[model samples]
Target chain A: MAEAKPIAGTRPLAPKPMSPHLSIYRFQINMILSIMHRVTGITNYFGSLILAIWIASAATSEQAFNTVSSYLATPLGLVILIGFTWSVMHHMLGGIRHFVWDVGWGFSKPAVKFLSWATLFGSLTLTAIIWGYALSHWGIR
Target chain B: MPTTTYRTELKKVRGLGSAIGGPGTDHFWAQRLTAVSNLFVVAFLVYTGLTLAGAPLGEVKAFFGHPFNAIASILVVISTAIHMRLGMQVPVEEYMPHGLKVPFLFLNTFFVIVIAVVGVLSILKLFLGN
Candidate 1:
């Protein structure tokens, strides 16, 4: 074996630690919260498109408006409507969290966890409350 | 004589033509500003939507005919369209490969414009009874 010489005034190679991707990291609240934020955002785009369609239908004619509304009142349509409602609520709460982080606060470990949980549960709670009010007053059975 | 430290020549050429540049912070600010505005506009939108859902056609038209509801609906559509465009632009720019990114960016802009136009026109038609 040949002998190797050490170089002068040179630093030794150091292994840089790569941040873990999705698989390696332990499951955390913020992970799901962040992913759901993006999911809800994308979903909201389609929901907004539907909303525009509904508005346009209303503007077209009375029969057109009733046609759209009748379909939306069906079971499958209600499911889609509820899903979109939840997405909007979740995305809005998640957006508020992002805004707080943008202002340079809520980066602490506890704060992050708190905000994530709050977003998740707050959205669900608000959605339920709104739907409850909706069902009670609107007689949507 | 001592030379002056001012770069008047550089200042004159800055932001003059194709070589123009900016800090590009306005995009960030605009996104955040629209997001904030959307918070309120979206709430109003939900309230109005829920109230009008499955109602009689004339009732729905009368509801949207109100100036407050009409203005709020317009604001919601405009703010949300801008916010949606900016939001989608980020993912398309960051995650998509180079070739795909360009097409997606163009699509994003077109989609937002279409949504905004349709939404605004719909609301206006109701408000104007035309």
Candidate 2:
């Protein structure tokens, strides 16, 4: 065997530590809250789409508009509208949380948990308040 | 190196800066556009709803065929459909697994496109005085 010379220019390689995998941990409150945020966001998106269609239909003519409005004014339709309204407010609050996060606040462990609860309780509370107002404004409709 | 930058002081840094570097521009601009479009839509819708106050079916139909009504309706539909696609896309990216991501994304886009086309055409057919 031929003798090999050691190179002067050599660097040591540190064995990289393997971080624990995400799956190793059980499901968490923050994870569920994040998922809900996305779910509400999607719902609100579709709700807005429906709103667009309603407006377009209304803009077209009185008959077309009435067809859309009367359909929307029904009991089942109102239920869907209420669900959509709640989703909108919920998603809006969640969005503000995200925006706050974007600006670099509410990321400490305790703060994160606090924000999670805030997002949840705040969304639900706003949703309830809006629905309560809605019912009063258009009660028995 | 000592922390000369003020950003280093925060114990937990939010990854918001990346938004500006990558898809941030597209998302921000699109959101602004959609918001403006939707405001007009809301306004028109509320107005039309009020106009329908005690109005008969015949009057309603004629109102749709009205020029301002048709133009505004079409514009709102176009902006809304585009907005819907953009809004839902982020959620799909966030939640769906890698294996199912591509397919679901396609489906999402396809679904929105179909709804938008169908919706706009429906409104047009109703208002264009066939």
Q: By lDDT, who's the top model here?
A: 1
TM-score of each: 0.83, 0.56
Which TM-score does chain B of candidate 2 obtain? 0.73
Number of the top-ranking candidate, with DockQ as the measure: 1
Q: Per-residue error at A125 for model 2, in Å?
A: 2.3
Question: Which residue ranges in model 1 land beyond 4 Å of their true spot?
Answer: A1-19, B1-24
Per-candidate interface DockQ score? 0.27, 0.14
Local distance difference test, per candidate? 0.84, 0.67
Tens-digit per-residue lDDT, B9-128, candidate 2: 221245455466567778877865775666577457545644653455566557778888867767766776777788777777777887888898898888888777766676676587
Mark the 10 consecutive residues where model 2 chain A has the least summed lDDT.
Answer: A1-10
For residues A42-79, what per-residue lDDT tens digits would candidate 2 score against the true structure?
78666766665664665466677678777877888878
Assess candidate 1 and give its TM-score to the true structure. Answer: 0.83
